[model samples]
Target: MKEDINNDRILLERLKNGDISCFEILYSKYSGKLYNYVLNISKGDFYLAEEIVQNVFVRIWEIHRHIETEGSFGSFVYTVGKNMFLNVIKNRMQEYLYHDYIIEHASELDNTVEKEVEYKMLEEQINKLIEQLPPARRKVYILSRVKHLPNKEIAALLDISENTVESQLTKATRFMRENLSPYCEIIALGLFQFYVS
Candidate 1:
């Protein structure tokens, strides 16, 4: 076990320095064990198992520079795989819950008129929140978020630095998030559409 740890530490250093052979060696050493581990936990979902293993390796490569040389690399890899799996599960649950909520709410609304009214109310609430921001912060928030402009673009449009644009947007978002905690799910659903598009 001690020798194995030392060997892994050396390999990790080489991998961090961009050695493809070291990456291949590391993959070969761990991929089978990781795959079978994920496969068992995933309850025989072969495709998902394969994807998780691949993602683990990809993540390792991406964060090679940050990899610790004093600990078990296998543990780090397993932690990454576990986190990925949990994220997938969390996202799926959120989707299921969102659909369930929408279905329940849709039944209550029943008609297009009610739906329109509800939508208008939500939009007005969103606008009201935006209106509460300080004037400069509101402009930055609107340009960066509502108008879907990049920070650089927002800065150029407002004749400010990109850092200023980012700072103001961050403050605006923090304020909104703090005040709108109750509406987080609705806000996430609304913004997620924009993010995906």
Candidate 2:
């Protein structure tokens, strides 16, 4: 907790100075948590939660120059999300209309989970394919992809040269592409899109 606070302070200081990377890193760290927090409070109104999260970030960007670098950026964003949600609710007519619209479109909303399920199924399929890889290639590929290790780290761990690690990764990726893409078009559009495309 202390480390995260200190890190947020550093990121906030950089963001106030107009550093886009700092803003991006902060977004990556907080966006999912913020979205989930808002989504729960908004009673599973996906669109409303999404809007509040977007507004929170936009407000942060707008006020970057006035940001207090010593404070908790996480708390600041959540407070903003909460306040924005409250303001939306205070406009009772809008909330009523939004809920009415949601009730009418509940069936379509139900399909959203199916897409997520499909993505997970695709992930499982990919993992099975990975298991079929040659041993050395499999280790290098897992270290690179699943563990997200750099080529140098992978090489050091495997007691091989960086060039060898790179070669193994290349071959492993080609194998997945050739085997999976032929049967799974899901790869062409999902997170694994780069592999198939």
Number of backbone collisions per candidate, in order?
Answer: 0, 0
lDDT, residue 66, model 1: 58
* lDDT (CA) per prediction: 0.72, 0.75
* Predicted structure 2: clash tally: 0
Q: What is the TM-score of each candidate against the true structure?
A: 0.59, 0.45
Clash pairs for candidate 2: none
- Range of the 10 consecutive residues with the lowest summed lDDT in candidate 2: 188-197
lDDT of 2: 0.75
Question: Which digits, one per residue and each the tens of the lDDT, describe model 2 over residues 1-197?
Answer: 34643498888887889988888888888999999999999899999999988888886787676677666778878877887787677556545755785588677557767767877887787889888999889888887777444565465456689999988888888888777765464443334743322
lDDT of 2 at 70: 63
How would you encode candidate 1's per-residue C-alpha lDDT over 1-197 as one tens digit per residue?
Answer: 34543498889888878987788888988999888888888888889889989988986786576566777888877766776676567567767886886787776546767555655666777688889989999988886666555564465456678999888878888877676667555555443333222
Top candidate (TM-score): 1
